[model samples]
Target: MYYIVGMHIHIVPNRGSRPTILLRESYREGKKVKKRTMANLSHLPMHQVELLRAVFQGADLQPAGLG
Candidate 1:
């Protein structure tokens, strides 16, 4: 069966500290894209970098004014 996934990106800022980031996804069905499971992959080296790269690749980004 096929499923749909929704991606969300969050940016958090703290006073006197560097910003924090969070990436979450919602699955329209039971299935999930293994590569997007953030918790499971957070321990890896340069995890945030990897996550952003994967997110861009997974989501079909388009120009701001395009339909």
Candidate 2:
């Protein structure tokens, strides 16, 4: 079975637009590693993105405006 073991953050560049920040889950399936996107954080501000990054790092605090 595939199991998610951690979260990963990625920044994707775009032309004529701000870079996109993505949240993904890292999964382990036997000896292989796989990743799946969990959220698209491109619309969020930098501060909020930092906050969410903290959450992904196992912080107990919750970020606002994530609806």
Candidate 3:
């Protein structure tokens, strides 16, 4: 049996501006690894970003304005 799970931030380049920050999930499918969008953190505040990081680190979180 085998399985893979992980999360990380993705940077998407923009034409003439800063790249967008996206939270992504990575997993293994058969012999290939794939990534999926989990959230977009470009517009989040620093504190919120920290909270999201905590959530990804297995902390219990409550939905406030993260929608």
Name the candidate that leads on TM-score. Answer: 2
| Residue-level error in angstroms, candidate 3, position 25 | 0.7
- lDDT ranking from best candidate downward: 2, 3, 1
lDDT of 1 by residue, 1-67 (tens): 7666666554557699755555666665344344243433333355565656566568565657999
Candidate 2 lDDT:
0.83
lDDT of 1 at 39: 35
Per-residue accuracy of model 3 over 8-62 as CA lDDT, tens digit each: 7666889998778799999988889899998888897767767776877889776
TM-score of 3: 0.61
Model 3, CA-based lDDT: 0.82
User: How many steric overlaps are in each model, in order?
Assistant: 0, 0, 0
Q: Write the per-residue lDDT of candidate 2 for residues 1-67, one digit (tens) a residue.
A: 5455898678889999989899988887778988889999888899878887887788887347664
- Model 1's TM-score against the true structure: 0.34
The per-residue C-alpha lDDT of model 1 at residue 67 equals: 93
Please identify model 1 stretches exceeding 4 Å from their true place.
1-3, 27-37, 40-54, 57-67
Worst 10 residues of 2 by lDDT: 58-67
